[model samples]
Target chain A: MNAAFALIARDVRLAWRHPNEIATILAFFVIAASLFPFGIGPEPQILARVAIGIVWVTALLACLMSLDRLFQAEVEDGSLDLLVTAPAPLELLALAKVVAQWITTALPLIVISPIVATMLHLPADGYATLLLTLVLGTPGLSLFGGIGAALSVNARRGGALLALIVLPLTVPILIFAVAAVDAAIAGLSPRPHLFLLAGLSVFALTIAPFAMAASLRQAAE
Target chain B: MNWHRFASPSNFKRLSARIFPWAAGGAALCLGCGLYQALLVSPPDYQQGQSVRIMYIHVPAAWMAMFVYANLALAGAATLVWRHPLAEVAGRAMAPIGAAFTFLCLATGSLWGKPMWGTWWEWDARLTSVLILFFVYLAYMALNNAFDDATRGARASAVLALVGAVNLPIIKFSVDWWNTLHQPASVMRLDGPAIHPSMLWPLLAMGVGYTLLFVVLALVRIQAELIERRLGALVQARLSAEPAA
Candidate 1:
């Protein structure tokens, strides 16, 4: 447990030291969401209808963009070996990295989502539900994305391959998250969709760490 | 029958060779009968008319898509848990075949849907999940070959398969909850089949035929993979034995 916290702290500190990485991801999230209006026209109703989906998808893409560096830096600097060989459980360490990643990347995206939602003309009723879905769904993204990062860390083509591996797995999260917000915007109860989103996060949490650990062990081998 | 003995690559090779002929012959017989019955003997649907014939292929291929993924995951388990060389080869060999079946399912489904659902595609729950399943298979194949080191690729992809296995049920459930337009199970229901026997028989025959065909293809692919690995090993051995190049 202490080791997990230390791992989290170390990762957070490292991320803090390089503020540009976080800034870039946040910029990508905002810029990518803004591009949808240009692509499809700035019609308020059309933008409102697609606001949640656009935000969710662009956020997913931004998260994916950041995932390439998740373990690449560790692998290159040789700290991955130290982490693997440490007395701390690798699964716990894996979870720590995921948590750290969520804190650095997804959390910021979540914080900025409402502003993007507003710019996209999302229904006022949806702001809360959008934030709720982002909070619930982004961790699942990071968890599954961590598995992709670890698996592809040693691969020749990491970026495209990581997206290919991770995107399909994230379908459930995207469905539930978008549905929850859409339901809220339509004046329907978002509870059921929110429950499913939460369920997916829990499921990913339980399953992803061990997968990450196994893939890391193989990559480090 | 001692299973452990056959875990050895050479022994497994011999066993697969022995089984290949039987599997291939059975596949030939079943597929011939199935096609005959499906195309000629089976009654057309009351609602769909002759277009219902596509179900004979679509349903079986869809079943094979899921079945092959399940087998691949099981093979992945064998590879990771036992570090069985044959399991690694088998997993690598099965991925593309599974992807092909998944593609067949999607293509045939689209053909049937155009005449029935009046659209080539719908974001129906089952269809969407199956599409995602197709993507998963593609991802598995991509990951399996991404690395230069064969063992590392195998191990990494094995972990991925296991992760995908864990997600498959969730994806199925979530998508079903989201929305559904595709018909529910007609044959595998607890209250026996809802499909008529005239259609059922041919579909079942085709299902069996497809499974047998998969077995034959798998055996052949595994044999090829083993031989390829042996060739690689021999080349490596000769290169090492040559001293400074």
Candidate 2:
């Protein structure tokens, strides 16, 4: 557990040095959300209807955007070999890194979501559910995106390839997140969709670290 | 008589060369008879008329799409667990073929949907699920080729295929739920309501034919990949021997 904290602290410190990584992801999310109105007409009703979907999708994309560098820095600097060879469990360490990644990336997306929500003219009633769903959903995005990051860390042009590998897998989270917000707007019980989103997060948390560890070990080999 | 002998690449190559002809023959015979039965003899549906003929191909292709992914996942497990070289080869070689079948399923389904549903595409549960499956295949193929080192690429992709296996059911479930919630004016029949014996026979025959066809293509492609790897190794060896002219 101490070793896992150490890993998390180290990753958090590294992310602090490169604060632009988190900034770029947030900027991307805001920009992407705003693009929908121009592409389609900027009517309030239309944008309000699509606001949750656009926010969820662009947030998903922003999570994917930062995934490329999740392990590349460690792998490139040869620290991944040290991490693998450590007495501490690599899977535990991987989970820590993933937690740190979510903190730096997805957490900010959750924070900035309301501003984008208001900009896209989201119904005031939907805000609570939007926040609730993002809280539930972003962790799953970070976790599954970790698997993609580890698997493609050794690839050329890995960012684009990472998107291809990760986007399809995140469809369920996207669907449920949007559904929960939509249900809230419709005055229906959002619990079922929220529960499913939470379920997906727990599933990702359980499996992603081990999968990342396996892929990281293979890439090193 | 030992089954493990086929695990050896040379032995596998030789056996596959011999087996390909028979698989191909079986595929051809089944396809010929199935298409004849489907197009010429099977009664047209009272509801769909001639468009029902597309079912003979679309349903079978969809079945093969799912079957190939499942087999590929098993092969991926074999590769990862036992470091079985042949299983790695099979997994790598089967991905594109599986993707093609998935693409065929989508295309034919689109063609079938137009006449029946008034729209070329619908976010219906089964169609959406299959579309996600196709994206999964695309991701697998991209990951398989992305690395500088071929073996590492294969191993990474094997891990990916395994992860995809774990997610497949959840994806299907979510899409089904979404469809039920939306319930957009249901038009196309999901199970044919009641499949007549005449339509069912040809469908079964076509499914068998498609599976056999996939096996033959996968064997041929796996052999080609093995030879390609060997040739790459040989070229590397010869270049090292020449010593920087």
Candidate 3:
């Protein structure tokens, strides 16, 4: 357990010193979201209607941008091989890495979404549902994305391949996230979508770590 | 687990060769009868008209699309649990063919929809979910091809196949689960088919035909894959035996 925590803490410390990693992802999210207003025209009514989708899509892309690095760096550095052979459970190690990934990548996206949301002119009431969905949903993205990352570690077209494999399965999260936001925007209550998101998150949280770690172990062999 | 019986590739090959023709013959007979009934005998949909003729192709193709994914998932599990090399090969061999069928389902559905619904495409729940299923098929193929390492690619693609399995059910029930333009299942209902006997008989025949065709395609592909893998193994062995350059 400590080893898993230590591994996560080590990654955090490393990520902290070289915070450029998170910076680039946040930059990409902000830049991508900014492109939408120009592409779609900056009418507030239009932006407000489209804001939830824009935020969710940007978040999805931002997560994709960082996925290749999730396991590749460890694999390249040879730590991944050692980690696979370690006595401690690979699932714990996988869980911690997913935590580190969400913290570094998705956590920033959630925090900065409000700023982007404001740009799109989302009303005050929509904020709760937006924030709630992002909070609940992004971890599932990271955990599931982690599996793709692990599998694609040695692939020739790893990055795009990871996106392809992960994106289809991730639709449920996107569906509920957008639905939750749309529900709030219409004053129809976002509980059902949010609950579903929460359920999916819990499900992903429970299974993904083990599944991803096992896949990584197989890849390493 | 009875590894020796299957471990000897020669024995397995001989057995598959003999069984292949039998399976192919049976599948063909079923499919031929099914198609005759479906296309010729089954009455056209009251409203959909001749376009409903496509229901025979579209519904069966859709069923096979999901069915193949189920096969991929089962093959993946077989690899993981039984460590059968054939499992991975079977899984790998089926992706492109299965994906083609999925594409056919979408194309045929679009064709059927345009004449009936007066639209080329729709965001209806079943259609949307089927679109997602198509993406899932694409993803499986992409992940399978991504790795430079063949084994790694196979393993990665297997996991992706398992992940994509969730969409199969979503596609199947999307109409029932949500209010969608695409109609509910009329053929494979719990209380027998809602389709008329004249229609049901032919649809069943077509369904049988498609299933047989899928089996034939799968068998042919699997055999080719196994032979390729063996050749690969031989080449590697020969290369390793030579003195270092």
Candidate 4:
């Protein structure tokens, strides 16, 4: 427990010092979200209708952009070997790194999403659901992306391969996440959908750490 | 009694050669009879009428498509756990074939949907997940080829195959999870197939045909992948024999 927390603190400190990393992720999110309005024109009705999807899709892409950093830097710098050799279970340490990653990537996106939603002319009611879904869904993305990053750590051109592997697997998470928000926007109860999303996050959280640890071991070989 | 004897390249070559012809022949016979029974001997759909005939091709192809992916996942797990050399070969052989079956399922499904639903595609949960499964298959194939080192590629792609396996059950039950236009299982229910005996036989025959076809194709391709690996090794060996100019 202490080792994992120590590892998480180390990663968070590293990311905290590297503020530019978080800046780039937020920039990508804003730029991607901004494009949707221009592409579809300034129709508030259309934008409102698609607001949940646009936010979720942009969030997915932004998470994807920063995923290469999840394990790539550690793998390259020899830190991963040291971490794996340490007394803590590899899965626990990897989960800590994923925690640090989601904080840097998905956390900022959640903070800035309301402004993005406003730009897209989303209704005021959509805010509560929109925030809730991203809060629930983005961690799932980080877990899955961490697995992908670990798998591709030794491969050349791993960025594209990571997307290929991670995107399809993240489908269910995205579907339920977006559906929850959409249901709420329609005045329907989003609890069932939110519960499913939470369940998915827990599932991913439990399983992906072991998978990521195994892949790291393979890559470190 | 000799478990490790099959580990020899020469032994595997001899064994695969002995079995390929029989597997291929059985595949062909099963497909022919299955198709005949399905298309000609079966009763038409009560609701969808003649358009339901497409189920003979679509359902079975879709089932085999998922089946082959499961086979790849199992092979990947075996390779990782047992370090069985044949497991890697089995996964590589299955990828393209699985992609082809997924493609067949989507194509036949679209054709069937066009007639019955008056559209080529819809965003129903089943349809969407099946499309995602198709993409998953394509991604496996892409990752399989993306690496310069074939062994590295095989191992990495094997891990990916394992990842995609996690998606199969989700795809299978997507319809039940949500209100989907695609009907729930009529044949694969827990109790028994809800289908009538009158309509059931042809579906069973077609299902048998599809399963046989998948096995035959998989075995043939597995043998071919073995030979391809051997041929590559031979060429490399011959080249290494010559000094770099």
The model with the greatest DockQ is: 1
The residue pairs found clashing in candidate 3 are A155-B147, B31-B209, B34-B205, B34-B206, B37-B202, B38-B202
* Model 2 Cα lDDT, one tens digit per residue, B131-197: 9999999999898899878778888899989999999999999998888888865755568577899
**What 10-residue stretch in candidate 4 chain A is worst by lDDT?**
A173-182
Q: Over the stretch B1-245, how does candidate 1's per-residue lDDT look in tens digits?
A: 43332234677877887888899999999899999999998888777789888988988998999999999999999999998888899999999999999999999888877886788986666677889999999899999999988888888888888999989988898787666413453212212348888888888989999999999999889888878887777777678889795
Q: Give the TM-score of candidate 3.
A: 0.91
In model 4, state the lDDT of residue B32: 78
Query: Residues B1-245, candidate 3, lDDT per residue (tens digit)?
Result: 53232234675577778878877897788777777776777777766677778888888888888788889999877877777777877888898878888888889878877886778875556556777788888887787777666666677778777766754553345333443222454322212337677877767777777777787888888788777767776777679889989
The best candidate by TM-score is 2
The candidate, 1 or 2, that scores higher on TM-score is 2
Which lDDT values do the candidates have, in the order given? Answer: 0.89, 0.90, 0.79, 0.79
Would you list the rank order by TM-score, best first? 2, 1, 3, 4
Fnat for every candidate: 0.94, 0.86, 0.61, 0.37
Residue A158 Cα positional deviation in candidate 3, in Å, after optimal superposition: 0.8
DockQ metric, candidate 4: 0.51
What's the DockQ for every one of the candidates? 0.89, 0.86, 0.57, 0.51
Q: Pick the candidate with the highest lDDT.
A: 2
Query: TM-score per candidate, in order?
Result: 0.94, 0.96, 0.91, 0.89
